[model samples]
Target: MEIDAIATAHAKRLSVADALLPTPPNWDAAAGTELSVRDGVALATRSRVDAGSPEALWRPLTEYRLNVRLGGADPGAAFGALLTEWDQLLEESEASDWDSAAVVTRPSRDTVGTSELLRRGFAPTRVLAVRPADRLAGGPPEVPGVRIRHAEPSELNTLVRLQLELRNYDEQFGVLTRRTDEERALTSATRELLADADSALPSLWIAELYGKPLGFVQVEVPPAAGWADSYVAAGSAGYLASMHVAEEARSSGVGSALAAHAHQLFDEAGMQAVLLHHTLANPRSTPFWYAQGYRPLWTSWYRRPAVQG
Candidate 1:
C-alpha cells in the first residue's frame, strides 16, 4: 500500500475542495482487499459485507463494496477506470436483488468523477448534513394540544415501532438497505439496552397529541457521540441519530417541533455542530431538514446490485 502517497493525495484534495470535511483517517490500516488502477496511479479496496454481521443488520443483504482512493493524478479518470473494473466483477458475481455497490466521497471536489458514476446508474441517495451550533436556542415550537417530553421506559414498544417506520420510509430511497429480520434484531438490542441499569442511553423524546405518542427524535451528545465526535473538523459534535413521525401526523407541525426541541438540547449540550444522515430522494425530509438549518457535508453515492450498468 502506498500509504504516504494515498494520504498525501487525500489531504491535498480536501485542502482545495472548499468543503467542511474533516482530516482524513490514516490510510495504513484501511480495511479491505487492496487493488490498484492505472498501474497504481489510483488505488481501491473490495470488501463483501454480509448481512449476517451485527453492523450489516442495517445494511444491504450484501454490499460488494469497491471503495476508491482517487488520491492520485487525474482523479476523474482514476475513478472511471476503478469503477469499470468493479462493474465487471459485479457482472460475474451471483448477487441478490437487495445487494448494492457503495461509494462514499466528498461532494465538493469529488464531483469531478461523479459524472461517470451517474452515467453508470449510481444515485446520490444519502447525505451527511451538519447544523452549526452557534444559532439561537429557544424552547420547543408550540403546537396547540401537543406535548413534547422525554420518552418513558414503558414506551419501548411504541418507540421501536416509530423507529421501524422511519427505517421503512428511508429504505425506499435505497439507503437503509437491511434484511427482513432487522426489526427483530433491533428490538432485541433495544430491549437489552433499556434493561441494563447502567447503560448510558441517548436523549430520546416523544411528541404526543391528545395523550397519544405521534413522533420522536433521538440525540447523542459529546463524549458519548461515538463516531460523530470524529467526523467534524473542530470542537465537540452531537449526532441526531434518528427521528420519525407517524404517517397520520405528517405536516401537522410535529416534526418541526421535535427538531426545534432537539436543537435546543444540542445548544445546551455545548455542541459545536449537530450531524445527521438523511435520504436525498425523500421529497419531504430533504426540504424539511434544509429549513431546519442543515446542509450537506458529504454525499454518499451508490448503485445497487453493482450490475445496473
Candidate 2:
C-alpha cells in the first residue's frame, strides 16, 4: 500500500495501455511516472463534475480515476482487489461525494479490467485522440462562398453565440447538463478568454459563407508542463479545444474547411501533434474525427448518476 508500490502498479498499467494503442511520439512516459499516494493509493482526480444541474443533483460530484494494471499472476483477483480498495477508500472519506467514477485503459480484445468495469455498471463515455500535425495533407479546401479567418475583437459576441449553440447540440446527447447559472458562467469564461491578451489557451476561428457566419473552431498551443504522461506530446501539441458547424452547413464541407485551416496554422507554428476529446455516443463526432486522421489514445469509461448502491 506504499506510494512506491502504488506507483509501480500504476506504471505497469500504463505500459499495458500504451502497448494496446501505442503512445504517440509527443508523449513521455516519465510524466506518468511521477505519482503521489493518499491513504495508500495513487489516485488521479480527473475533473470536478459541474455541468450545470442543481447543486443538490450534481454538486459535490467528482470522478475518481485510476489506471488498472492487469499483468500479474491471477490478474483477475489483482484487479478485483484494486477495485475493492477504491470502494473502501470512497466509503472512508468525505471525498467520495463523487457522483461518478471513471478510468481510462488500453483497449484490448480481451482485458480483465474492461470486463470488470462493464460488469460493475461503468460504460465508455468519451475518447481522447491524437494526430500528428504533419499528417495533415493538402490545404484547407475551397468551398464556394466560404471564407475562414481568425475572429476579430469585434466578433466576440458571435463567438459566444456559437458556443451556446454548440452547448445546445451537445445537450441533446446528454453530454452537458449545466444549469442556467452554469451556462452563464460558461459565457463569462468565454468572454474572459476573449478579453485576455496574454492568454494562449484557445484562439477562435470563424468560418463564414458570403460574409455570414457558419461555424467556428477553438485551437491552442498547449503548455508542455501542464500535461504529464497524457496522450499528448509535451511542448509540441496544438489542441483543438472545440469546433462546431451550424446544422445547415454540416454537409457543405464547412467543418472540413475549418479543420484544414486549423491544421495549417498548427503546422505553421511547428506543432507536432493535435489532441482533442469527443463523446463516443455522438454519432456525428466519432466518424468525423476519425476521418480527420485522429486515433484514440485514451477512452473514458463512466456511469452517470453515480450514486452508491
Candidate 3:
C-alpha cells in the first residue's frame, strides 16, 4: 500500500480507538507528527538505553513501535499484512545485532493487534495501572515496631542497598533487563534524587523497625511526555516509581504502611491519581497492586533475544 494511504487508514483507526478510551490520547497529533512508512506500513521507532546502569559495554536497544489502526474492510487481512512486514523488520534487526524490541498498546478485551502479537510469540511483560489519589487517603495499617519516614541523606547507602534487594526480586520474573554495576547506578540515581530539590525525589519513605530500614517506597511527579501523563489531567498525577518490602516483612503490614505514606504525600500535593507499572509475570506484584487499588491501563508486549529466522 502507498505510505499516504497507510497513514490515513491508521489515523482513522486511532480516532475510533481514542474516542472509546476513558481518557482520549492525542492520537491526531501523534499520527501527523511521528507517522512514517516502514516495510510498506505506517509506523515509528524509538531508540533507548539503560542509562541508569554504569556499565560501559552494554549496547543501546530499539523499539519498532507501531501505532497503526487495526480494523478495516478486511480486518484480518490488514493485520496479517502488517505482521508479515513486522517479521521482515525483525529479521533485519537481528542481522544488524539489535538486542531487543518491544510494543505498547492500550489494554483491550480483543483486538487484531493483540491476537497477532500473541501468535507471533510476543508476551505481555508489563502492566501500567492508575488510581485516584482520593482513593488512597485512608490511614496506613499499623504494625508494631514499624515506622515510615523520609529517607535521610546520611542513609543513601542504605537506600541503595534496599533498592538492590528490590532489583533482585524483580529479576526473578524478567522484569529488569539492565544489570551492570548496580552500586554505581544506584548511587548515581540517589544523587540525582538529592539534586532535584523542588521535586518529590527527596520524598523517599523508609519502613523501619528500631532504626533499621526493612522496606521503602518512592514517589515522583510523572514526566510531561510519559504515557501515564496522557491519561491524567494537568497537575493531578503522581508516579509511584518504586516500592519494596523485605521478605521477612511481607504480610506484616510494612508494605501497606509504606504505600499509605506514599498516598498521603500525593494527597498533600493535590494529585488526583497515582500511576505505576509492574511486571505481570511476577506472582507477588499482580495481586499486591490489585489489593492496593490499581487497575491496568496499558500493557507492554515484548519479544526478547531478537533472534533471526
Best by lDDT: 1
Model 2 / residue 288 / CA error / Å: 0.2
Question: Looking at model 1, how many pairs of residues clash?
Answer: 0
In model 2, residue pairs whose N, Cα or C atoms come closer than 3 Å (at least 3 residues apart or on different chains), thus clashing, are 26-233, 51-177, 51-178, 52-178, 52-179
lDDT of 3 at 70: 42
| Model 2 root mean square deviation, Cα atoms | 5.7
Clashing pairs in 1: none
lDDT (CA) per prediction:
0.73, 0.63, 0.65
Residue pairs with clashing backbones, model 3 = 133-272
* lDDT tens digits, residue span 174-203, model 1: 867757677777777666545655535446
Summarize candidate 2's per-residue lDDT along 1-309 as a digit string, tens digits: 554454465455556555434332322334332222232233333446455533422222565565544444455555655666665555554443334444544443225456767776667777777777677767777898899976777887777778777777675543355455755665566666666677553377789977898899988774632352355544577778789998878888888888888888888877777777787788998899889988877777765544356
Which parts of model 1 are misplaced by more than 4 Å? 1-9, 38-54, 71-73, 89-93, 192-202
The order by descending lDDT is 1, 3, 2
Q: Kindly report which residue stretches of model 3 are placed more than 4 angstroms away from their true locations once superposed.
A: 1-41, 50-60, 73-77, 95-98, 108-112, 195-201, 222-227, 231-235
Best by TM-score: 1
Deviation (Å) of 120 in candidate 1: 1.8
Q: After superposition, how far is residue 168 of candidate 2 from its true place, in Å?
A: 1.8
TM agreement with the true structure for every prediction:
0.85, 0.76, 0.79
